[model samples]
Target: MIEPAARPRATAAWLLLALLAAAAYLLGLGGQHIPKNGDESVYMHIARLTAGTGQWLPLQSEIEGLARNTKPPLLFWQAMVAGSWGEAWSLWRLRLPSYLYTLASALLVGALAARLVARPGANDAPRPPLQVAALAVLVYLAFFSTYRYSRPYLTSAPETFWMFAPFFAIAWSPARVLGSRLGFPLLAGVALGIACLYKSFALVLPVALALGACYQVAGPRGRGLFVLRRAGFWSDVGRVLLAAIVATALFALWFVVDPAPAEVWREFVVGENAGKFNARESYLGKALAGSGSIWGLIPGYAVNAGLLMPVVVGLLFAAWRARSGADASERVLWLWLLVLLLVFMLPSQRSARYLVAAMPALAVLMVLHWPRIARGWFIATLLMALLATLFALNVALGVQALEPSAGGYSAGLWLWLLAMAAACVAGLVKDGWTRPVAALISAAFYVAFAWVTAPLEGPAGRYDDAVIERLRGEAVMVPSNFNGDFERYQFLLPGARIEHYFAAQPVDFDGLPALLAGHRFVIVQRRVGQPPCADERAEACRVVAARWDIRSRQTNAEIRASLLRAPQDFWFAREYLVERLAAAEGRP
Candidate 1:
């Protein structure tokens, strides 16, 4: 977003750095502590189970109440192909598609942003297309929502790419869709349908709404607010309708292809899609109150930007100030964003994630208004990244100290952290460097997070090879606080019949082993310093192997203690793979 103070080479370097950092951000994506929803493992569980069946129809799931049709089959298929149909199943393999999809979308965003700015309307002064385009890619990748959901075997990346593609095309050249009645509409419909197949059918509404808005204010009618002529308006409406119908028809393929069409209708179309309408007591009341309120959702655009939230605030101000002067193309981007927001506002289950598809448009808008935005926003972003950098280093230190066996942080890893610290400092000081630094800072934090958890993928994070082989074809009870969280064991201890125990339940350290009775081999958790077998005579358990884990969902007190005092005590825990010597084969 910054005009190069000197040479374009520096800008190119920053772009390359941002791209590499983006890749590095997802380095340990499959680990336990990445920022993601519980749905990830659930989706993975379904995909793995479905992959085992070797048939595409009727998406599989072990999660009760939300069987076969919890989500569309496409995401499962994606995970299946990525994981090699359960033969080479690993969290990283399952999540690779998500990373690729996100990267593709970011590339499209950069090219579109450069195109939008290169034209006469968006920029205040002439800037190189390459510079603006590279910065846009960095900005899109820097988004917190993109960082959180764009990887980790989730549908966010594919849905974002497919759903936003049509808009990107329209914004790139309005005449393509608006010029031909059926050509663009049909193609756009196919794209939206695929997106719906990845995510949910409910998304079709927003896609349709955004497409309608884009067409209404595009071409000859773009300069003014309305189409004015009755025939022209009807023509546009018909085109939008055709697109929506096509998208819905593609979604209907699920019902047609699946063996149990009736179940797909009931479980997915009714339960998943229609169930969102089951609102609270009063629609307006709920809209005005609670965490799900319309007010909370209003600033979703900024919220999605995470550390770059301030930059978005500046973008909003800049857009408002230049509202009167903005061109049709710029306004089209605005309409797509606004329409998505308003359409999703109607749903009972409103989340910022619903607006992620429109994020590429947001990235374009950010690039167009970048020069006008305040430098203070960049400073704010650098400060946040600086804080995250410290956390990364501190946690890495803690993790390293805990595991002397896992080769301590490599030189390359240490250098990466050092570079992050340096970038944060430079961004805060020099205004010229701030934009590029802000762009890569989020990815830096992602890398830091990955580094902190990277050891988990090593010996310290996994059981001994011999122990893993011993557990194969045997029952292994693991801790699961959420639906499908135990799916992690599929990769951690493969070929084992894994069952879940409520590890989140309050621990009775004295009787922890007794609590895991009836299973031959059980994975039990205890505080880092707490003894795994405090009551040895109880036949509670015999620790066969152990691994380190940064306990998830720590209390606020624990978090503060982690930073202020001993990191191991409050943040880390030990998971023991113990043998229950005297218990029968009971299940919880």
Candidate 2:
């Protein structure tokens, strides 16, 4: 345990790490290939298309099938405003709002943690809330999900902010917010409505369930049982019902305002939301089986933490151990987490990402029980960070070996990696330093990743201005093996229309030219050292420009090789922009 006299110094160190974690998130904001959800480009597509139309009522997208209006317009509107309707567009600028939202959510998480924790016993000197709050914020940012999902111009950060804002308020002042019949609930509804606009109106069910359950818990306590009249049950019911109505009404505004209400209903409501509860598979079977099973979701909070999963397990046991005399406000948070898990189970389509909005509660609970959690969890996190930093350092050194001509990551990045390794070593050896160092290493690892990938978003990995200029109005056939991935070309090649063909790993090299038969300009991917075109097809197409790329999807063999041998070969690729000289006239 940290001595009382030195606790302030310890808290200061945590506060510094919190600031570092916050700043790290912004360092490589504009990268073409950074850690992010696959749908980031898809969301960017809708936002760009909607901005092109000069209206926000109906969300626009060029994506075919049910993906056109898969989500409401708030996220699109955010991108439009951020990009200045495409006048001053950049990936960094577009992603800035999500970062801000993430920062705000972190602040709220810290605040909730600070509030939920009770004062230390009279025997101990008064401890600063700053210490716990800063750790909470650091832990939240250190989450791999926070890094993966929050940084992209996606729904996760903003939706997490608006959706969790109500709980933050309720936790901050349970007496006032929970007691209010209409005031707080109205605001909560609007907040949730905004969240729904970013995600789906289906979220209202979970949010409402959480709200009502919290209200019930806030009611007069009498022997762990509910007496309707004494518990103010009807008033609490009114609160939940009113909030649900407001949220639903606000979401329905899409239909009221959009030019194509029927399209919105069919595409968004039915295909996007209602499709989750399919009659083809029994709900119980869906819950119990396959990759999307509820079992996967049960441990999501920890899994989302990535390196700190052990700490989450420790936090869970700590919560269980402290359940008997827990604070009511804290119980509200537990109820919120429970409600999310329960409601999401009903949908046949379940994902760990859906549990993200509950992470703030997890952060608070961890902070409240930080001391109670066994030290082994913290040690495990430090060990994982040590291994990851070692791996990244190896990759960095190997990158130099692979491409000596192109300078690898800078000295500062090497030093950063070394620093994380050193800190992990120190934490592993010392009990008192373990927790704070665990957070620093987790956050540091993300920064290291961003620094290493920074060059990919720079001149070295991208096509020169000349290539982007020539391909302005042309149709370029690009390969896409994942959802909305080819949409990345809209930014890469500014006025070009991108067409896609499936090109998964073990790329069909023999069929490369056929893919470019109709299009004058096309992009093809090949592993480094491979020829741009097969010998027989050399005359069919000519390589105009080539740029470095990363093969994000890898086979098991590639993963094994990356882990055991040459990672640079498996991770890096060369993307060629080819012109079909064989085509008679290739405008179409």
Candidate 3:
């Protein structure tokens, strides 16, 4: 018979998950700032232009220049619908869907982790019925990366969802029968297909799942080569392939109804994913040229996941308790996790963000061991969560609060209270270390949601007030300080015409004047690794100042240049002809 504890645990899990989602939604609605990433700006522009024409196209040919068919239409189509509401909508509003996807992604992680812990041989098996579920929620909630990106408007959120959903479905395979097995894998296929539509690396997820299954079923056959001759292998492979085909068909449904369906598909799938992956050189140079291996941005990943060390410790402890009891199926969980981590770390092409795809597995690992950890460890985790909550509060209140009383929210305060509340829950659930840990996790999620919900500085805060003041109502040639800065200027200063140049490549000295024509205001800033033209007699773009440290100097120069151009309205135009040319042809 089902245990009574299961009902309460499940209820708590659902309720907490709902609460977290609500907080994310509220934060998204409140005065949250959109990321000022270059790719975001590019996407926004594409969306705007698509809305205008009722067809996807680059907004300003000279500015955006890329073929509109390059990226798959799913996200662009979403953005187009969003842009139809009007450009007057706030950036945060435009990014609302991404925020929703992020929250959904987080909840899925919680669910997957819980499922893993509920498996028969898991260390939490003999514990109270809801123990594993509560622990899963805690493990998921405490992850910093999950919290950080949970509020951002980016394809990564959707991509993350698609990538992990398949794994979750696959992990739950034993719960169903043979023909029914295809159900989860099919859904997994569709999710992966959508993920592929977002980013090419998405293919890795389904492939990893396949590899994981192979590794698991390969007892005497062998890890790498045994699958080649197995009878069940072809059947399994066929099902997965069918799922992939179905996923492709679902993805094609949108474009199939569009005017240039075939063209769009080819460009999106082949040109964007295949092109980007195969292309050895970037806009700067070879992608591998300047890239050096670092210990793979793990700290950044940790912070993003919201301080996950406790979860790791819990997972280890749980594993230790279940070591002797673990069965073949239980062992598959560890192997799958190992496969996920290996894939994430494989990309000598590393970024903290890349680790997101494997996050669900990490959460599962944490939850699997939640039952056996010591009470002291659970207490330590709660205190640490509270500390993080406090730090977030200070940043939001002390720093972000200084700006215009951002839309009726104080993310920091909310987050702090959340942490404190979790601490209280932990104290109450003092049955064993697991109960306390679960409570602490609940509290941590609340804290993170509160902290993120609070209105904070986005890319817009980086602008110079003086420059904003000076450029009011003036046509200007703006610096490509970052992607969204100029777009922000468009809103801040009505009637300001802008010819913005990104600093991705060296500028051609010839095209400066025509690019700046009919514009009186100018803003210039140094690009990373590119210092100002040292020559005092420089004729094209003059140095705004001698120096002002490093990153700060660029902003200072941009402000100074805007000031210098304020009087004559004849600001110097920096050349970016080369950079423009490179991206135009889809260099990187």
Best by lDDT: 2
Better candidate by TM-score, 1 or 3 = 1
Which residue pairs clash in candidate 1? none
Q: Model 2's lDDT to the true fold?
A: 0.82
RMSD per prediction, one decimal?
3.2, 2.6, 10.2
**Relative to the unseen true structure, what is the Cα RMSD of model 2?**
2.6
Highest TM-score among the candidates is held by which one? 2
Residue 151, model 1: Cα distance from true site in angstroms: 0.9
Residue 263 of candidate 1: its Cα lDDT? 90
What is the C-alpha lDDT profile of model 1 across 205-306, one tens digit per residue?
A: 888887777766675444344456634677787888998999999988888898999998888888887887765468788788998888889999999998
Model 1 residue 366 CA deviation in Å: 0.9
lDDT for model 1, on a 0 to 1 scale?
0.80
Give TM per candidate.
0.93, 0.94, 0.65
lDDT value for candidate 3? 0.51
